[model samples]
Target: MARNLDIALLRTFATVADQGSMTRASDILHLTQGAISQQIARLEALVGTALLLRHPRGLRLTPAGERFLGRIRPLIITNDEIWSEIERGDVSGPVRLGLPFDLVDSCFAASLKSYCEAFPKVELTLVCAASPDLLDMVGRGHLDLAVIERAVDSEGGEVLAIDRLVWVGARAGQAHKRSPLPISLVGETCVFRPAVSEALAEEKLASRMVFETGGLDATRIIVKMDLAISAWLASTVPADFDIISEDAGLPPLPSFAITLHRANGARGAIFDELARQLRNAMARPRLAA
Candidate 1:
């Protein structure tokens, strides 16, 4: 037999159940109390039983209503989600993300632009930090997603983009100088530190870390002074910096992975979608460095 209940009534019932009162549901649905009562009455008649108990405090679900609520809550919710997805198929809201300062110059700007253009309601708040710190923040729920270098460990992250590491230095910095070198390095927990260290170890050149700090600005500052040399993305090299040529005996830099991670569920799906867009954007030839 065909069901005769109104979908609108079921929607109102679900909203009333969720909001806990007919008056509240009326306000939500912009209906009068009498109309709300009539809708509930119609639903009760169709189902051949009472769905709600009129209570002094508020409307409460009857035993039948309780069972019905449990059974249809997820279905209604899923329907709502699907309808919402159809209505605003475009993405929206505060997309809190973390990323290393270096990658911003590459895809972060243009890719995010495309994301925003495609979904104007999206508002992004970007947190810049070292790879390790970014990963930690993403893992802790402090950030929704992150573009991080390799996972710090097994529990680290998911690889989203990968690129080869490259060495850079001040155009006339120590790496380009003849005398003993002043090596500028990033602080601990940064991906560059290990990359630089391993490169030095392979060359059997025991270089000293004369400067250590976070953020590209700090590295660029010391390098601009020509007081020390640092390694970073070839593209991230400041205008005053140059790549340390292989003839200088610096070992070839290693490749690093850009990864993304999220908490395990709906939030994860959201982040995964963002990560996928980032990966696609980075894949564009223009962003490749």
Candidate 2:
């Protein structure tokens, strides 16, 4: 008799590998922690070797596990795509998507790509703008779905994650310590601009707007060059910069409500599935550089 690999177990294993923690995998898969452990144990038993190593920090893939992942990841993705297409059953239409400019380099980029690959027939028109503008577009039915970062206590829309906003500056930069802090901002329409300004004012910290741009890449370059400090969601901050703290004399910024809004006319299975995929992708841990 020969042991057979289980698709369910493989799915759980891949999720754990992607998430780097059983707890996070459980959350993403909607399974109990014990259940995820059991699935991994069963998978290891099938292969007759350890697939994952438990460490103080988190889970790490064994050499065998890494090779196995490389082989099976494409298969799993293809299988899921097929299953999704079959489940949707002839659902095809255009989905107008609105993304904030800041999110283009975040997890949403990968998610959007995955969604497009899975449903190639669904015409996805994406527009990048500030959160306020995106929200307005979605509310007016200009976009089928919009992902926006709103103030933590703001109402309306399906909240996905509560993300912390932080002050960030170039690595080893002394710009943050300068009197009348030099700052870079998106624009007046940016949701973070007013909050960040108000926080600075409340702390009686004088600041100078040294740069302003709506492009995240340009802003990143300016920050990386130690030109000025700017505010960003902690998770979305580029790896090159250092997050400033109160000890650095920067006032604390409020958390943001990562919300998803759908137009009333766009309520359907396709919309729900897109939202589900987005949430799953966002829930995954940020990719390590």
Candidate 3:
């Protein structure tokens, strides 16, 4: 009889597919490129087909490989969901989580601390990235749970909290309103981008991006320079930037729905517990930006 494919191989394949590159996948899996390659080769041999196309930039799944991936991903996730359910009483072992950077500073940090204290035996792992990246990670079962901005909606995660998104910058006296209106932005997947674009359009303002970065630190510095403005969670305001009122001819910005997702099934109970804690935290009366 042919040997069954190992879970490790499935995990390696999923990581490579998500990253689109063996090198990057290796970095994430904490395995050598050769090891990742070996796992893929074994999987391909067992399945008797080419699973990935080697390219200078990254790997792309063949049609068959893509189909195979689609079928297998749910299996992996379901397995975790089952395990999580059984382990609820135990709630032990490592729990890997993904989170957006802005949220780390805003509220999740405290939540994480509480979770650790409550489940002292459960090891915690964290992955910090943008909302889109966090969503993708959670969907693949690489993360047990993720706190992402509102945009990443799919079958895997559940909504945790709802919050408004808004634009902010220096007060009129301090605002420079530079020509071309220097604008700063995170990557395209940032939930705030569309809101910012719409707000500018409503005001009939044409702005050019002077700085675009993945890091929020750069956003803070650029906006502080008074040469640019950006959109962020209303709760993420740093105290220096003043919220630009919607009636000030700026388009109405959308609110964000914070979502929590875990692999479906028994393993999802921890996510439920964590989600409960998070919603309770947000319910308290708080200042908006």
TM-score, one value per model:
0.60, 0.70, 0.61
Candidate 1: tens digits of C-alpha lDDT, residues 147-181? 77762233345444446666666665565453455
* Model 1 quality (TM-score): 0.60
**Per-residue accuracy of model 2 over 184-234 as CA lDDT, tens digit each:** 977667889989889988999999988786477788888899989999888
Worst 10 residues of 2 by lDDT: 280-289
RMSD of candidate 1 to the true fold?
17.6
Tell me model 2's lDDT, rounded to 2 decimals: 0.80
lDDT of 1: 0.66
Judged by lDDT relative to the true structure, which candidate is superior, 2 or 3? 2
Clashing pairs in 1: none
lDDT of 1 at 5: 40
Please name the candidate that would achieve the greatest TM-score relative to the true structure. Answer: 2
Per-residue lDDT of model 3, residues 1-119, tens digit only: 87565778887887687556787677556799999999999999989999899777668899988998877776665554465456556666777778787777677667578767766
Which runs in model 1 stand beyond 4 Å of their true positions?
1-90, 151-158, 172-174, 178-180, 238-240, 265-273, 287-289
